[model samples]
Target: MAHVRSSAIRARLDWVRVHHGQARVEEVIGALDRHELAIRGAASPNLWIPFDAYVALNTEIDRRFGIGDLSLCRVLGRYTAEVNLPTLYRIFYKIGTPTYILSKVSAVWSAHYDSGIASSRPVPDGVIIRVESFATPHRCMCLSVLGWLEQTVTIAGAELIDAREVMCRLRDGNACEFRLLYREP
Candidate 1:
């Protein structure tokens, strides 16, 4: 398969992260969820893959390759801004980072831009809302997502001093909390 240029991919990811918006996040999340479900033997009729499975597969691949590099994981996290499944999948296998896969999924619901496709709406600030769970793997999922977000900001020529957990009201009446961090050049 033809590969996306690393620089171009990075630029696209940076664009999405910097221009985060709610609608874009929803759209990308829907797209990514659909793609994940389409994969063979994903999980169930709901078409959701377990977060742990996602992490294990990538971790296994990394172990097999004997490459302990985290660059691929970082890149995959960056790519989530675009909801580019093909690129994400390729990076998952090529770079072998479990954190990358989880971050990509979270980015689908957090980052409001599609690096693979153009959008007609304004991008929102990359605000990540974490859903707490007792599942250990799910916790890892949250960390991976935060890691990716931080990496994305750094790649965009900004610095993220700290990400503090805070509750933010969503469109729905229910309130969700995520690690809120500020960025500056």
Candidate 2:
């Protein structure tokens, strides 16, 4: 299975702590703290965890968020804007159009997935990001990615038109394909 930086989980927890109640934030943080005995001692915020664990954390976030909707994705995306995107921005966003910046997505995504599970390419409308395999379906993750893409594009100075998943891995499609559509403002 693929792995993700624990930073993703920590960042979302920060968002929850600010917007949601403190108890729920602690609940999620506490759960991760208890993910294993050794982790309780001092898990590096940058440590890598299985992608499934990251997904599970997102699901728990939705549950405790009390809405259990794609809005959680919006929240995740907004938070991503504050932290993740800016770092990438400094590296990739040099007054480039969204298309130009997005052309670098394959590299950034590889750094996140840390495996060969993801790829991105420009299309007529925007971009197509593929997760080659996901044993389970996760709308929250998809939506969160969508939201992140939207924010990232906007930060790149593009006007986002729409974004959606056109193919689902669980639906027996070849891969989970997220289609993004945007245009320059």
Best model number under TM-score = 2
Model 1 per-residue lDDT at 87: 59
TM-score of each: 0.33, 0.81
Model 2 over residues 1-185: C-alpha lDDT tens digits?
66767667667767787787778666775675435332232256567777667776677777777486656866686576657555655555646787776666677666665664667788987988787764455676667767777777877777788887798765768778878898875
Candidate 2's displacement at residue 170, Å, is 1.8
Find the 10 residues in a row with the least total lDDT in model 1: 114-123
Residue 112 lDDT in model 1? 26
List clash counts for every candidate, in order.
5, 0
Candidate 1 ranges with C-alpha deviation above 4 Å: 1-46, 65-75, 82-131, 134-143, 151-181
Whole-model lDDT, model 1? 0.37
lDDT of 1 by residue, 1-185 (tens): 11122223233223334565545433433444433332234322233344443444333323333264423343344444334335555444345332233334444442322222211111133344444322232222333345555554444444556544343222232333444344434
